[model samples]
Target: MATPLTAPTTDPGCRVLGLRERKKQRTRDALVDAAHRLFLTQGYGRTTVDEIAASVDVSQRTFFRYFANKEEVALAVMSDAEDYFIDCLRRRPADENPLQAMRAAITEAWLELGQDDQSGPAGVTAALELFELLETTPTLLAAHLRRTTEQEGVVAGVLAEREGLDAAVDLRPRLLAAVFGAVVRLSHLSWTSDTAAHAAGPDGMIALIERHFDQLGPALAGSWR
Candidate 1:
């Protein structure tokens, strides 16, 4: 997963930060990196804020300064990816339908994420390991589901905007978003269980996601004989 903290600046107007801000950024990044390593090695349930902070040689209070709690820091990587995915969806061409926009957006998002893994702080291997941990960890999985439900509303609003439809009155956007979210959840579950997919990493997961999306129409409309 691309550590959004360390992602290269793409904005032409990006300003050079002062020393204090740069130092803070470094601290936050260190905390996130330490948290991920501890979570993966010792298990999220067993890892605590103190241990993460200690690993980064910072006070526990400093960890709380950047993240609300262990869960927040633990899921920061996934949150960054989600934010990027939404941004990509918003940038999709207006002519494409909601489903097409979503499909293209996710593909684009994953491709960029994969590229970042090769050169970024946490590679795809760490990402896949973290993903498996998230799926198996009950508390994290529940929190993830709750976050996904909320994110669906945001996605639906984006879809509604693209179509010039009021999401409050029009059910299509919300309904489609729900279905898309479900498909993604199912794909995650499938990928987590498939040993071969684990070996294939991001590319394999992307293929599985595409396959799930392709099956959506047939799975919904066709009779199982």
Candidate 2:
């Protein structure tokens, strides 16, 4: 967990000299930005923690202050999306069914992402490339999978609370969360492989996900060969 940022303070004969919280945030962001650039260009396996810290003119100790390892830095980019989805899920209306709520939450999350300036111009192309990096790199893939598992548990607990079920005792909440996660992973694999899909970019990925959600009914209820 991140240490809570301290509020600026002042007292008689005392002064808050600078924006300590903002400076820490900037350093953390710079480390992530530099790491992503190196990981994208030189590849994750080739990049070293020292190089990441040096790129930001910070010490190895400073880098460790922000992230435990290179894998943590690599996943920080994706963590924003994860956080957005969970926040949206928590805010969805009580009347909506589980699947409907998931869909609506993701839609809102993506809409907010579209308006946000943070993604910037290394662009969606860089983001997709990073996804490809995760898919192909063993160490990164393992880390990604671990994060995915942790997020699934979070989603399941959220679902249980919203539906008034005991998450520990009832299986429905976990089952739905598992299915939703599987669909997301499957959609990613399908979207990444279709060479013809490159031109569509982020929108194409979203469309693929929507199509997968559309099939969830038949996928769960109908027979398969």
The numbered model that scores best in TM-score is 1
Where does candidate 2 stray beyond 4 Å?
1-18, 117-125
CA lDDT of each candidate? 0.81, 0.75
In order of appearance, the predictions have TM-scores of 0.90, 0.85
lDDT of 2 by residue, 1-225 (tens): 111111124211234535785577667767777888898878888999999999988899999998998889888767756766888899899999988899888767655554432343233445555778889999888888898899999999999999999999999989899899888887778778877655576666677779899999887898876
Query: Model 1, 117-142: lDDT tens per residue?
Result: 75333555566667788878888888
Which parts of model 1 have CA positions greater than 4 angstroms off? 1-6, 10-22, 118-121
lDDT winner: 1
What does each candidate score in C-alpha RMSD? 2.7, 6.4
Error of 1 at 62 (Å): 1.3
